[model samples]
Target: MSAQAQMRAGQGASAQAEGKAASKANPIVSALHQMAVSVLSEQLREMFEKADDILFDSAEKARASDEQRLYLDTMRIVRVQRNKIVQAFQEALQAALAGIGEDEAENAAGRLDDMSQWSLEDGDVLEERIAVNNMQAKASSLYAHELVELQRRIARLAEMTGAGLSPESMSPQRIIHAFQNSMRDLPVDFPIKLVIYKLFDRVVVGRLSEVFVGANQLLAVHGIEPSLDAPTPARPESRRAPRGLPQDSGVPSWAGKLDRATMGAFGAPATGGAGMSAMGAGAVPGGLAARQAGHLAPVGGAGTYTDSMLAQDVAQILGSYEHGRRPQAPAWLPPENVALVARMFDAYYRDPRLPDNLKPVLARLQLPMLKAAVADPRFFHDPNHAARRTLNDLFEMLLQFGSAEAAPSPQMVGELQGLIDAMVQAFNLDPATLRESARPEGVDERTAEAFLREQEEMQQKKNRARVERVRRIVAHEIRRRIGERPLPSGVLRLMLSGFGPLLCLDYIRSGVNGASWTETMRLVDRVLDSLRPDAGRHAEERAAEEAELVAAISRRLAAIGFSEERLKEVLSGLLQAYLELVEAGAGRTGAPAADTVDEAATAAAPLPPEKELQGLLSILLVPGSWFTLWEPVAQTKHWVRVKGYYPVQNTVMFGHYMEERFLQLRATALATALVDGSAAPIDPSPELQSAIARIGELSFERVVDPVVWTTVEGRPGQ
Candidate 1:
């Protein structure tokens, strides 16, 4: 076998072993396994039902085969579920990590701790239960609106046709058409058009007006007309009987065939429809047509609707038309195209690597996809349609957002909304004309497969290009920082090994988001300090650098308008902290203690500079820290203390803060120059002042959290 195949096989074997060992230990894994088994059992039962006619001669025979089928199905399901659970858990964990910021040391640590404690039997179960409840609540809200609309529309239709429906004509196609006609006033690209179309599926609609009820005196109290309970005519002759004729023996002939006609309308026979007796359409209680119609109708009799129901139905239908439940394929869009795009999103949504929250957002794209297809045939006809490419870009953005812990930023949300809005507007311009325009120009089924393959290859190429660009950017920045100093061979080797690729990917991201120069420099200083040889000369040089940093920072602050006294105070405090940090590192600070020469020797042993540097750099250069370029490591002393600054959570916010400060410093220096008559007077832009005011208005707490400098239990070497 090839090396890749062998590696995969080994991994599979190892994972299986691990899962077996942890099955009893991890309640979460156990629950997932159990859920998988349950799903498989239901699937097996379905398979058996499908094969009943061919595989079993009788009920007894079917029962006899159950054990064998169950055993086989269970074996297969266990394997599938194992793979699924491992992949899904890994993906969820990674996505969770993506949201944490470099300076969010506490949060990252807490997240890991919580993850470690997760048990499907307890913590996750509670969350899942909560999620389920929220989903139900949303569904309920949607249902209420739908129920009202259905009642209103049905009532209007009933009034128009004297409260009766023609069963044979209420085919799925016609019902969909009726709904479409009713919503003619709505915008062509409205999302509810898709929801209404989806509900047209026969399984969901299920005999729209079907009803059932008892034949006895119960009908009297319910005010259900006896003739309304008439069943579907089992014989053609009964159907052909005069409309006024009494089909049921219990009905008086004088009451006329309208009762039999009513029975036919309800799709119920006089003897009752199957298991039901004289239950009229109104008596059917509730059906899928009711429950699933949460967006359209309530659980009510199919025969009649009240004014309240009509009002509700009208309200919901209008509400959906105005504010869609989700994005959908636009009207006049092709089903083939809709299905193709839907399949793509479904694949992404179902992928184990993606977070679950993303599914709803991804699913909304169906409508937009359909709208795109209809608006420009090239979206469906060409392999490299610009619209399709844009969609692919959006998909990547969505994945990135999903991977993070924090909610997507307002800017991203606005961008997505604007994109969708533009598409809908373009689509609405001439929906009628574009209805059939895309199909004839589109690729045929045979070519479609090839087109999709080519597109997939292009997508892969794009991803590779992106990674390479980011990698180059990171390497450039790191090299620039190192300047004339030759990077140690060991450090270079570490960079070239696995570290470079990952770090570059992260650094590029930070750069794109606009990492501040101060943050970048701090990271460089930390890495260099950790790795630098601990010679006596280097220690003396570090002390000089510390004094230099204090002076430089104080100068910068003073230039930005800090009073001399404040600058001196800040400088004095920082210098004292640096001294303590250096002394602690040399084991010359802290409480006085009696120690032998051996103890001193041990403390002063030749520092394994390379090893210590590697350990420190490895800890701080983790991927999560790349975005913010700051992370806290557990240590006894601040080995590389420069300034008491913490990284912000986002590059935009960081850039904003830095820019505002720079502007202030620039104005200060310019004013000083002007007073000396060495420079021209400067006038501040009104916009700049407004921006500064807005920045000032923002709470410091919202932009960044302070990192606490604390002495921990152990240092890296210790």
Candidate 2:
């Protein structure tokens, strides 16, 4: 029964057992087995490192934690490695079967059904090799599980570390307050909460889907990452106190010392007077970090409280934008937040710096990105204002700033438009109106054809001369009202272009975020206050409202602190209001709101409009009918703006902007009229003739000649 004799005779069970015993007894074999196990673990770790890069975001701080990282890496590698070994073994087995004689192959595979470890003797040494492979695979799996457990330990340590984390300073009491406040603010039956509950309930039924598991797991994993960075000491300050701050003891074994620069900024953070476990006993003010397990325990079941409907709507809008929809247009989007986003973008692009305090919050919100896109000079500098040309333009471009999940996913404009359409639907609007409104923009061939056909019908009733006579009468009537000067004519166009946004306010409110329309109207009223020719009442009403908004801004701005610069900022904001209201006004009919007439929204702040505007408009009881935004040339930023929505370009879209456009139309015609004796010829050369012709035609085309407007005498000539 010597082992060597048994191996030489190895053909039966007794010989096989003897061979196993010899293999165990031999030092050389034992050393080789140990070497193989080490090799397997190292390979698994390497595989995991690659997978981690693909699976999760790279963390600057987390990379240093070798123990935690290595374990996770190994586990990932183990799974891949195990799967690879199985595939190879299966392929080898199949190939072997194919190579065997036909009858032998059939018999061999059949034998596999009843195969045991002992069956290796029947198959020869290949079967024994496969058995060894199985054992190694099992060992790797066990090792991977151990790594998972170790990673869990690191996560626990992260929470225990007393190195207080957050975007701002907070005491333990503050933390409690913040959580309570956040929880209390949560909607009583928020859809997200319900979804979380549903997920939890489904877990018991074993129906939890992979997506549910994945999103929830992602939220849970973030618990270990710091929400905020602790303030670090300045290099100069920390140089003196080289050994100032100590590492928090409860932190993972990998968390060593705070860098020299970070050591002396602030004292260690205390939680409930908890001693520092992150440091050592009696080493810091805080005894230990707050136990985070209590905080992280599923607040509301699985915490999948997100609304699928909202998400779907958002996703659709986002997708539409991705497919080419814009949501960032200043006028088209019309959200105050969108305006703020635009302004923020301009400032951010100009400054290209962010305050440290805001960075953490910025990380959570994707607003910064929209601003960035707006600031991207290469794309945004087009004189055509093409970037946010439409709502779809803004929406589609919004995705560029963040990952898919973090992108701004607005709800569909059409879905919101449904609310606008609700009226047309409910009232059973006429098909003609629908057809008119639904046509494509810029070039409507069908409309042109229809117009041409109608013209032909008119022509059938009368000759070209008769049509010409009617056109002259129409032009004359418009000229009589719009006046006969170019300056006033341009003013008319500017005035009329401003009113559409104010009127569209109602239409916009029908969309999903339109509940804010009331607030917007209030802002608009502040802009419109100075334009009214007279004031009967509601003057006090307007003043009170503007005051309230000012007070609110003051209180909020106070927290950010005040300075001479701050005063100027507030005053400039008011000046913008004045420009939007009194300074921008063109032509007005009714009495202005008394309170808003006297003051801009921030006029009370230091450096009031009177000082800056030289009290020019201040003395005028007129607040005036014509607020000249620009003289000679329409450089809005360079010239002072007069009251009204009429920019140097357009105003009629706001309120009575079209009335001005009408006046400008008339004025343009009159200005071109002959002062018979002054010029060499009444008519200029073809080039000048073409320019004037185009202008006259455009003005005539734009004029409002509704018969009723004619009845209001001096409507344009005035």
Candidate 3:
């Protein structure tokens, strides 16, 4: 037969196969997707029903699980889940459509392009939450004014719709034309639906292009599959000493490609060993119970490689002496814990990205590994042994942390600290250990340095751990309080965890909301009422932690931010404002009407700063376009002590606070509205003067504003 005739027969067969495959697969995928989405939407509808029941019912039974008690919690969880399912639906629909014929997919794409007319997620879900809490007209107005214009742009393309044209005639921007015609009443501001629709449009457009590409290429014209080519796996290197190279006595027996699985992860033979056992297949090592529990006997390759598997395997082989109870461990014995420490050390040594502060901890590994090598009398001359030993030392530090707020373990953080202090001293004594440890043949210098840095980082972490523990306690307390839960532990620890000392200093120096010393004491008293509300109920272990926290905070405050000098200055300024304002209102003896209080004087010290506040709070919750004033000192301190000192909780609380404060100030300021709306003669009392002076003083840093020196200084927004 002729070649052209043979090709025709082959093409006919291929077309028949493609047609049959499409008929089988297309409807199946579409049905699966439809079913999944239907189920998900039904689940969502049920959730909404549950919420409606909660909201409308006068009395409802509480759930036995005590979960999702908050209204916000229920709404948030439901909404987020709905969004996840929505995204999944979108992905599935697009994927299934990709399996359809090219023309059919494009037709579907045209329908989805009309999504610009669909209402997606609404911003009211977030914005309305802000509006409801803002009772003061000032905050409400500010929020209303500082808003995004929800406008929609409908593109109407000019297509040739002249005589003799088809009835389906539409412009090049046909999608936009359809959207405009579909709108009931378009918004004046940026359109949220349009933005989301545009994203979907891009995906469809890409798909359409791919469909065309396929039609123009192999899909339109039959193409042959190319033969496959791939590199063969290389054989494992032969196990033989290098010619003329001296063998190190300590080169461990299972060193090269040692059993991948220790404890059965690598599938090592189950021997009933500590870290080494591969699950025992038969009996020689151990019975069924142990192997099934994953206590594996050490054997050759069983699974994926774990770098530290051998170290643990070796340590188990050495046997557990229970803290050196053996009169004298074998002359060749290494500390069992050293294996863990060595693994940690090796990782740190190999990692160069470690910061400088952590080098001390990284340098700590040399001696432990070298000591092990010396005892074993192997790898005496091998550099790799030295490198591996270095890592062992570094791993010691990595294991320093895992759990939170637990009592310090002796072998992990405690013993290591002492050993580290001693080891560095020895290094200082005889620099020769560097060479002695470096004698292991296979290691690199950079790895050694990385190990050193890792160690230093671990030490820094330990030092910082004290403060972090306290912060954790505080965050837990706040989260618990907001959830209306019982206090978990002493409140003091919760306060001291992260930059805990620094925050305490801020609290001491600047009493909350510019309260007077007397007022501050009163607030503290009220605060202390809850600080130990669950007193005498703490676990013995937790009680010790709380006491430790209180003492630590007290002691650490002296060292924080120049011994509280910053605190006293800010506090003195704040207290004077408080007392002066009190006197201005009611002679400090009589009951001052809330109206008599100079609203500005009542202004809380700008904390967490104005810029941060503006960035955090929505306009709907504030009095003016401006939200919070960023105090220069506070901003600086925030950056220095913590990368972003404004905690999310602080921002939330301060957002609520700013709204209230803005309303108070604006109430009096707005009085000018009665007459020509000119500036009101709001008297600046001494207290107000003090507060303003303090604010300006903080902003200026006891120096003139740099802008004052510039030609454009007086102009706004420069």
Candidate 4:
């Protein structure tokens, strides 16, 4: 009937023999078990000391009087329970290594080599080191949690006694008395003494920072057995360090309090009201302390709210961070706004049209949205609020622009800009203020907006116009190849539109040698075959085509270090757009809607030449490439002649030479000149050359011939 009899009965002769063998074979497991037992026993002792007499009537008095028969019986039962727990751990350890190979066991156990001496060159060794550190951290955390619980109990006991057990005012005698009375179950080692001092240190700086004191003295004398000394008076103002303010000295006198200072910071009290719990009834405002000290039931509470309701509110406030979803609301987010924003973010996150690359941008909007909601809840709270609708539109517009390879059309940009300006004006908000609130460091709103515009202009030069130039050259080559046959203009245009941006990107990423018409056409043919009308019906077929296009473009993108998942998605979207155009031209339009054409059923329409040019300009402006000026050399005789040249490094690829293999011009220079349509350069000087680096061949032939020239006499006509 006794615990010892039961423990002995549970472990049969065979089981006891196996446990003994396991403990001896795995000394590491035995040591770990010993450590766990020591910690658990101390924790049990603290729990017994903290629990009110109502919970276990004899706990306090029984433990103190070991001479009593009742106390001896309790010890025997505790010892039996402890042995059972240790034996269970030993059995678990043995089971874990039951099927492990000798080498793996040796590696896991740190038996082959002392882990501290293992070189970190091998990934396996590094991982083992990390695993060891993680285990140590877990052990330390467990120890710290128990210590925190003990400190909380001590504070509660002090409040009950009305003696106010302030760590700051406690003498060596009091510290030793508390340790002997409360922690006698723990092994009296330097490690346990240090941890006790660490607990006092955490209380001094944590939520209880304003209440508990004397960490500096305790830390100074930690790890040494205490000698009885007279208790000091209440703490001095100068001796108490305020929370958040650093000590004047680089290191606080209590700096050596804990090995894990960061962990201790979190252990601070969560509320400023915690100090009231440790104070006397007179110290508490009104009867707040008395209420908190007693069973924490409301004085007039009945059935106002149920436990389930409170739980639901807590869950809603916590957001979905635990479920592995992103855009989680901050812990400080108000409960009312939590569900609304969570639902809104969920919808945006799930939209298939939203690219993966723009998710981060969408997430960043969460904080700004929270701030705005706080500023004006009515604008954000209503599902159909105009401001909310405008914000959604803004996010979509940004996603579209950020996702595209080329810049958006000038008209489109103007429209969005107007919308943005209108939204701010209509809401009576300041653009500068909003920008300052949301913008991260080093990212100026004006600078980013300017960069986007520059992209539009740059794209205009290199994109459509330059692509057209390549198309014309390709067209000429095709015409020559099939002498009298009519040109396959439809197929050629399809190829050019679908693959042009990729080829241009390739040319820019590497040199012109990296991409050629011969190679580009080869990939284009594959795309064309996969995108045939019949193949479009098959999801797998379309996916294959998308994969091929992405693979081709990604190779060059990788070279330029622009290998983003969203880039592939954008290319796939473009392919779909082009295929829809070709399919529409083949008269494959489905039924029309009563009010408007179904978006999927409608044919894709080409943009007007001006619009397309604007779009092209937008695409060309981006992160890389330097805008430069190349002045034409002049020769004067009877007439003045200005010989223009594109000075380019052989290594650089220009947009105009997308189809050209042997030579590549700088897209920035050619694009700038084409946009201006002027022979006059920005004027290259030593300072400018050093800034932009103009070290290349003066390839005059690469530049387009001039339509107008200046005469020696400064006349317009020659």
lDDT per residue (tens digit) for residues 1-718 in model 3:
6785465345435534553453233332222223333433343344444544442231234353333233334444434444553443333333232232233323533443455633542564223212222211222121110110000000110011111211111111222222222221223222333322232233222122222121112111111111112111111222122224443444332222122122221122445321221211222233322232232222343553221332333344333221112112222333322332333333343232233234435433333343444333333333335334334333433333322124334433443454444334332211223223333332233443344344433422332222232233323323322233222222333322323334432232332343433332343233333233232443454445445544443343323212233334333432343334335433546664332334333233334333322222221122111122222433410000011122333322111110111112221111112122121111111222233333333321122111111122223221
Which lDDT tens digits does candidate 2 get at residues 268-331? Answer: 3531211111121123222111121221112242433222221222223222222222223222
Better of 2 and 4 by TM-score: 4
Full ranking by TM-score: 1, 3, 4, 2
How does candidate 2 score on lDDT?
0.27
Worst 10 residues of 2 by lDDT: 674-683
The global Cα lDDT (0 to 1) of model 1 is 0.33
Model 3 weakest 10-residue run by lDDT: 149-158
Alpha carbon deviation, residue 430, candidate 3 (Å): 42
Better of 1 and 2 by lDDT: 1
Per-candidate local distance difference test: 0.33, 0.27, 0.29, 0.34
lDDT of 1 at 169: 19
C-alpha positional error of residue 370 in candidate 1 after TM-score superposition, expressed in Å? 2.6
Worst 10 residues of 1 by lDDT: 655-664
Model 4 weakest lDDT span, ten residues long: 258-267
